[model samples]
Target: MSILLWQIEQHLENHLACRFGHLNYCSLRLLQEKDMVQGLLKLQESEKTCSGCAIGKSHRSSFDKEIAWRASQPLELIHSDTCGPMQSITLGGNRYFLTFIDDHTRMCWVFFLQHKSQAFNIFKRFKNMVELQSGYQIKKLRSDRGGEYTSLEFSKFCEEMGLERQLTIAYSPQQNGVAERKNHTVMEMARTMMHEKKIPLKFWA
Candidate 1:
């Protein structure tokens, strides 16, 4: 019985010394209260830095306040993004999809594609359809620095059409928040609907 108690004490002491010694006493106490660690009584102050603790506690700076996009007219500005090479192929054999969002109306258009190369053609079709319907041509398109939007053919088409291309910086999705948020909403809604209707995974085209 004494040996068992001694083993427990050693384990607890080692845990404090090696694992969670970097944390202050209050945090250690809280962790003990939550039963995250067994037999933690207190933390001893030490000069040594805990590499794991330093990494775990480090955080990136918060993003700057968002500047909302305000368009005066439909098709004046459009935000676009492409999502997935999904894990499962859809019934239509499409593995990827693209989305376009109008900044003014918040209207969205979705197109399914089997390859990324299809994005430029899809955008052309979308532009014609929306312009014909609304009698307003697209002025500016804002999207991430995707190869589909940066291709020579895509750039030439935009130039000929007098459409301004606004590409977000690499690795910056927040700069294209409208389309990103719309895509997220669409995905979540689709997931919920599929769950409620018990729709098969293949039908999620």
Candidate 2:
């Protein structure tokens, strides 16, 4: 194990400029022929090494079943979700962001909010915008069972508007996979763009 660690350290030092901790899990795991954690710990003498690999590599299971896309047109089905209370608050004191995505075109709408309750108003705006732009009524809407989406007001609005509302089974994010995945993508992109532009971390609102 020590020998393997030495070999990895030497190899990484030659090709990489950053500390071992900065390299991603995949890169570090290459040091081990098998048993990722065992391989990394053999080189534990260096405090400079990133321990992220040891922790991250431990998770090997595949994701839950993906929700099947069943709609054909833009407004035929829409997926809605909200993310955050970002680790850092935005300049305007906004902490949450809502996103609505069309299952067909993959187009999305982003709205920043101070609370999850704002999801209701965002949905209203998105429904109005899409209906006007495409001249097609929303046929179905899908989201997690967050109170924001399942509230009496929300239910009444959907019923009155004649739109079908679908809620994923409790604790089953994969059942709302489209919106769940898009939420991660948007936040990841936001994080990358914010860092690249040197935007203040708080402006994620």
Candidate 3:
């Protein structure tokens, strides 16, 4: 026990607020055998209840598993998401913005729509634009299992083109975290830009 006293001293010095106290007979003897003399001495001063220790030692919920996608060229795999029904509607009665993001280039396209139903047509326009410019058909499409993505027209169009529709499991946004996070980031950036520039928030459409 005496030989390991230095190690106990080193450990206790850094985490002073956290100390083991009121050890059972077995634990105390075990510590003694390990030469944890410093910790033993400090334990006398430690309060029975420690807020810092409780907060630091509390268990946290595990994070969901993340999806890994191999990098692809522009128009190869597009992430589509919608953000909307903003509290403050635009003058044009726009309530939402459909976003199309290229997986490889990270370039984004925004289309303002008054209803969620417009997502399908907006996707069509995005497809045409990407195909014309990049000369590549989208080989894969990824989105959450939103009603918009499951629409018959959208599914049929994707099937006919031999495109793989990768819909995340219902209610699991983390599975499509890239697009979900992009929507959040864009909203934050748009808010900051409006605040800094003194532009009307409704123009975010």
Q: State the displacement of the C-alpha of residue 74, model 1, in Å, after optimal TM-score superposition.
A: 0.7
Ranking of predictions according to TM-score:
1, 2, 3
lDDT of each: 0.76, 0.71, 0.69
| lDDT tens per residue, model 1, 1-205 | 9999777865664456444424445656677678877666644342334344344334323334468759999999999999888777897789888999998987889999999999999999999899999999899999998888899999999999999989999999888878877666556545544554566767778
In angstroms, the error of model 2 at 91 is 1.8
In candidate 3, residue 65 scores what lDDT? 44
Question: Model 3 over residues 1-205: C-alpha lDDT tens digits?
Answer: 8759867864564344223322233544456668866545433322233343233323323335466765557777888888877978898999887787788887778788898988888888888888998788888888987788899999998898899988989887777766776676556545544554466867876
Measure candidate 1: CA RMSD.
15.2
Off by over 4 Å in 2: 1-69
**Which candidate leads in lDDT?**
1
Candidate 2 lDDT tens digits, 1-205: 9999788876665334133423433444455446644424333233343333333333333346565656787789988888877888777778888888888877788889988888888888888887998998889998989999999999999999899989989988878877887676555545544544567778666
Flag the better candidate by TM-score, 2 or 3. 2
